[model samples]
Each structure stands twice: as C-alpha cells, then as structure tokens.
Target: MDLNPKLPTLPAFYQQRIEALLARGSRRLLGLVGAPGAGKSTLAQVLASQWPGQIQVVPMDGFHLANVELDRLGRRQRKGAPDTFDAFGFVALLKRLRTQAVDDVVYAPSYERSLEEGIAGAIAIEANTPLLVVEGNYLLLNDSPWNQVQALLDETWFVDVPQDLRVGRLTQRHQQFGRSAQDAADWVQHTDEPNARRIEAAKAKADVMFRWDS
Candidate 1:
C-alpha cells in the first residue's frame, strides 16, 4: 500500500538531501520532532516506506515509561510529558543504533497506544538499513539526556502545523483510543497543550523547519 498517495509527495529537494546522506554509505539517523499531533510519525513512515528496506523508523514513544511505573512515580496524569519517558534509556538506544557493528541487528521497543505500554524488541534495525528515521516530541529538547539525542542525529527536522489543527488531531486520537469526547477534549487542553508549548520552544534547534501543510 502507498503510505502517502493522497498526500503531497515530499519535495524533490528534501528527497535529494536525504539521498545524499544515504550515498555516504554510513548508517545515519534523521530525527523528526514536533508536538504530539504534528504529524511526525506519519511523515517518518511515509519517508521510510518510500525507501523500502533501506530505511526504517524508530520512534521515541517506545521509551515511554509504563503506566504502572508512571503511576508509581506520580506522573500518570502527565504521561506524554518529557519527564515521563526513560530519557536515559532512549539515549543509550540511540548510541547503540549509531555504533552497532555492520552485521549486528539491533532491536528497539515500540509503544502500543491501545495498551498504553511499551513493547520491547518490536522493531529491528538491520545491518543493511542505511537510514533510521526517529520521530518524537523531545528530540530537540534542551534537557540532559534529550539534549544528548541531538548530537547523535545527523539531521533533525521540526514538523510544524497550526495549533488549532494539532489540537483537533489530538482530540480525535484520544477519542479513537477509548476516551469520551469530553475527556478527550479535556486531555488535549490540560495535558497535550502544555506539552506542545514545551516542544515549540525547541523548534529553533532543528536543522530544518518543515511545515507539513505545504
């Protein structure tokens, strides 16, 4: 299936830019960072799909602390906040992915929204994969472990979209995942909006600022 047949194709310039990185023949990590509903995951998937086996997506959501752990730490209410993730663990994974031996296959965790948990070893980065597209809200964050991520990425793009559109997307996503309409709206206003603000502050650090609506 075509991942982005209806959506506009990635610009020729961006495609060529990514191709140049692959041409270097060294494993490279490209990050797509943005607010919760700004389309980073979709963009990463579309780009990776275009390259088939040569590219793969490794999402940072996979580092989200389990609900049980979050509750224990009194952060269950702010599950998507930067502090709710295992930041150090994510940094470690990025380092491994960057320096893995040519023949080594590295496994990474993936987040399951329905279950609200992280499943270990759900993604495999094969030796032949030249590009790994990492998407997350904190890739550009200036905090400790998160700040460490920027150095590992060869290039990081900040995905941008209108705030109203992002809030609408977040509401629908929450409703689809079993929240009531009111609850979804409340969550977006109280939870996601705050996180979005934090993410927006780091946009300046991106190598490229991308407006998806274009």
Candidate 2:
C-alpha cells in the first residue's frame, strides 16, 4: 500500500478507542469501503500498521470472477462491476470468518493486481484475530449478498478524494500496471468513473465518510 494515507483519527470516526476495536473476548469486523482509487485499502493497512497483532486486512477484491469466467460472460471490460464478483461466495466466507471456531484458521482470497486476478487463500485469518479490517468497493451496496456485508461488520468507513486527484492516481496506477497512457485514461473515464459515482451514492450508508488525505 502507498505510505501517504493516514489513519482516521477523528473521535467520531470510532464508537470507542482504536484499542477497543480489538476486543479481548470477541471478534470484530470493520469495513473500509470506497471506489477503485479512493484509498480504502491504504487506510486499512495504515491502521493495521499502527496495531500489528490486533488487526488484519482482508480485501473483498479476492472475489473477482476469473478472466475465463469474465470472458465467458463478456464482462472482461467491466471487471470491477459488482456483478463481476462472486458476491455470494464472499458473503459466505465472511459468515464463516465471523463465527470462526476457537482453533480454526480461516483463509481468504486477495486480488493480485500484477496478474489481474483473485488468488485463493492468499490471506490467513487466525482464530485469535481480534479485529479484521475488510476493505472493498461494495460493502455498503444495498444489493442482496452485498447488503449482507454491512450486517456482518461492526463499523464501516467510506474514503474519498477529489475526482481530479482520484482520476490522476487511478490513471497512474493503470499505467504502472502496464496499461498505456491512453488506455489508462480511457479506462478511468469509462470504467472507474462510473463505478465511483455508484459508490459515492452509497456514502450515506457508511458509518463515516472522510476524504483520503491527498
């Protein structure tokens, strides 16, 4: 994750202190959500960096439909859309993680950008994990399985930045990952922007919405 982002420090950002988030006798799931380039992952990782053992991040991007599946459905170009994800699978995984056994170790998937695919069991959530920071694009989405995500999370944060900044970062990200400048710009305009607007519309559903420090 990039190092520029900061942890959400406002008192209202939490129902209690950060330490309280890591319950001693219970497990807590916190959702950090936003559009593609809105810094939700960065924020979650930063928070984890602040408290090592007590926090772990499990990204929802791990549910991306395989390239083969995307092509079969003609959704390769619309990869980040909600329907392109295994929403039911993700919800099932969260349900298992929420009620994880005392000695059971649960594994979750993570998206590998270099390969542009979801890698299975890339993240291990131990039974002792106190808080899980689940970051994703559609955690607050009102759709069926996606809506189930909010009910499972104890708290949720929506991160954002100005469109120009977000667009610039997204373009650079695409370029860094091998897309040409023109291709990156076109993707941001055609794909990312539409998703961003949809996510922004759900801002009201988050527990808190804060600008990602630029």
Candidate 3:
C-alpha cells in the first residue's frame, strides 16, 4: 500500500506546473506519448490519481481499430501501428473535449484489453473537468492527423525507458493477454519495436521527455 517508497513518484515541479494549468481557469488537455512498453499509461494513471476529480485519463488506445477491421485491412499483424488506429476520429474527439466539457458529459471510448476492442462511451468525462490526461503512443507523431494532436494539447510528456526494459514489459503484457511466449516475443520484435522507433523519434516534439521506469 505504501507506493511512496517503491513507485516512481512524479517530480514536484511537474506537479506544480500542472497546478498552474489548473489555476488558469480554462480546461486543459495534457498528453503523454511514449513507446509501447514505456509506462505511459502507468505514469498517466499516477498523475490522474493524485488530482482525483480534477483530472481524468482519456487514452488514445481507445481509437484502435477493431480486430475485424484490422483483419479486413490486412493490418492485424501490426495492430499497434499508427495506421491501425482511427486517427481522424481521435483528433475529432480531442477537439470536442476542448469545448464539450462545460456543456455536458463528454464521453470517451476505452480500450478493453480482455476483449481486445474499444468500447464506446466507456469513459464519462464529467462536466467542467479541469484537465484531461491523454496517454498514447502517437500523440506527438508528425504524420497527418496524429500530428494535429500536439497543438491541441496544453502540455505533453514523452515517457521513456531503456529498450530492453520496454521489450520485457511488452512481452509480459502480451503473454498475459493469452499470447504464447514465442508469439509475444515475435510480436514485440516484428510489430511493437518498429512502432517504438517512430514514436521515439517524435520525442523532441513533446514539452518534456523523461524516464517512466515502471
């Protein structure tokens, strides 16, 4: 229960900076972009937990194309790749989140890892929620609609860790989701690593880049 000693607690300055954003009296979108196994989700959850009602995570994974659609497009082997997501729809959601927060609940899709699909209206972002912690692998990508995401965010952080650690975590995650050990490793090497390279290349576009070390 004592995460104080074990977890990678966020630095005080980062907390202060987020507080300053909340003080601005306007809704803010904060983005967390990183490689597949780099702990972006973990870091975002930690931050959002600290702020409680003031911050909620709106993940880009929710924009993942369905397994059936990926199969239809012949992209099932590369499910986590940027092209396999609904980039335009994700961008539209981010734009809507900017204004819809005060008028009523702004519902966001959520990725169901067990079912391996995005469930619509899974996250209900409450009215006047002060900040949204958006986490994903491609927010800072310079390609088309994903590129448009950076300008929409009030601030962004690119989470990172050594490649070996990332690969290990990704393999373990895949295995947990019913992948055979060899299949998990193969997926990481052939699929996730290629995407990691592209995501890592865009780190310079983030407001800050740091090790998440989950």
Candidate 4:
C-alpha cells in the first residue's frame, strides 16, 4: 500500500482511474471500505465532486437498522456492527444497481448522523450513472451478505490511517454528536475499537489500498 497524502494530486490521480472504468460504458460500483473515522466518506465526496453527474455516492450507513429495532434486538450498543445493519437489504439494493438498466431513477436510503437513523429514499441515483461510489466499513468483510458486496463492486479500495489518528477523529466525532468526553472515550474503547479490528482484518481483500492523513 502507498501512503496517499491528502493532496490535490491524489484525487486527480483517482479521477483518471475512475474515468477509465467509466469508459467501458457499463454501470460500475466502486467501494471505499475502512474503519470508522478513516475518511472514506471524504474521499467518496471528492470523487463524486470531480465527476458531477457521472458519479453518485451510496453509503452503507444508509442501511443501519433503526434505533427502535436495535433496542428491540438488544444490539443498540453495538449499533455499527455487522449485525446491526440490514445486510440482506443492502445486498439487494446493490444487486439491483448492478443488474437493472439505468433507465429509471433508483432511490436509496441515507443515514442522518444527527438523528442516528436512516431516512428512506433519501438518495436518488439518476438514470445512466456510470459510477457508484459505495462507502462502508464492512464492504470487505468475508462474512455472509457482506461477502456478497465485494463481488458486486467493480473495484474496492481500503483506506488505511494510523490507529491513533483514527481514534482521535472518532473521539472528536462522538463529542460533536453529543457524547460527554468520558462517555465518548468509553464507547471508543468498548465499541468502535473492536469494530476497527474487524475492519482491519479485511484489508487483504481490497483490490487497492492507500493511506490518508488528515
């Protein structure tokens, strides 16, 4: 893996690669997989911005089970874990995106971090979108429905960042979302770190891997 500095050249470099995929004239799904706070969303946004109408971002966070459902399943504390999401539903959506003719608009769910819930049909993938950037933590996980994800993507890239830096970003994110300092630290120690380990284990599955420093 190469250390990819968060510079203008990096996005430009990737834009060229994405364009090559689009040149094939088929709808393609590109995955950006990484642990929490690893900047996958930022990278996806940059790519989408580079190719206005040609690329659309459909994040995996959109499939998160509602808080009510999580509480009922007793999985609220492990909200970001694999089991907490509608894995099959996510897979179904991807299948449709991959197989259906891009003649009609497709609606996809979107997650609202402020509400910690998913809003249905929040993102619209327009007809003939050449590239779909799917950002998620579990995209490379070799488990059940998640394993189905990699096969659907034309390319998958894993974002690598130093553990300390990722943890710091996560800490700040938790605080920004209303967690007390101590509570945020505890959650990171008990929840996010374990998920991070699981995400790291799948790094070998990525077609390409790159490190980013924010």
My TM-score estimates for the predictions, one after another, are 0.95, 0.92, 0.94, 0.94
Model 4, range 1-214, lDDT digits (tens) per residue? Answer: 2222244656555666787889989889999999998889878887887788889999999999999999999999998999999999999999999876647788999999899999999998876888999999999898897989999999999988888888888888888889999999999999999999999998998988867666
Error of 2 at 136 (Å): 0.5
lDDT of 1 at 187: 93
Q: Which predicted model would earn the best TM-score?
A: 1
TM-score, prediction 3: 0.94
Minimal lDDT window, size 10, model 3: 1-10
Q: How high is the CA lDDT of each candidate model? A: 0.89, 0.85, 0.86, 0.88
Model 2, 35-122: lDDT tens per residue? Answer: 8888878777777877788889999999999999999999999889999999999999989989999999998999999999999989
Query: Which model, 3 or 4, shows the larger lDDT?
Result: 4
Q: CA lDDT of 11 in candidate 1?
A: 83
Please write out the lDDT profile of model 3 over residues 1-214, one tens digit for every residue. Answer: 1122123566887888789889988889999889987887777788888888899999999999999999999999999999999999999999998878456888899999899999999999886788899999999888898889999999998887878777888888888889999999999999999999999888988887766454
Ranking by TM-score: 1, 3, 4, 2
How big is the positional error of residue 66 in model 1, measured in Å on the Cα after superposition? 0.6
Best by lDDT: 1
The C-alpha stretches of model 2 lying farther than 4 A from their native spots are 1-17
Candidate 4: residue 206 Cα off by (Å): 0.3
Which clashing pairs does model 4 show? Answer: none
Error of 1 at 97 (Å): 0.7
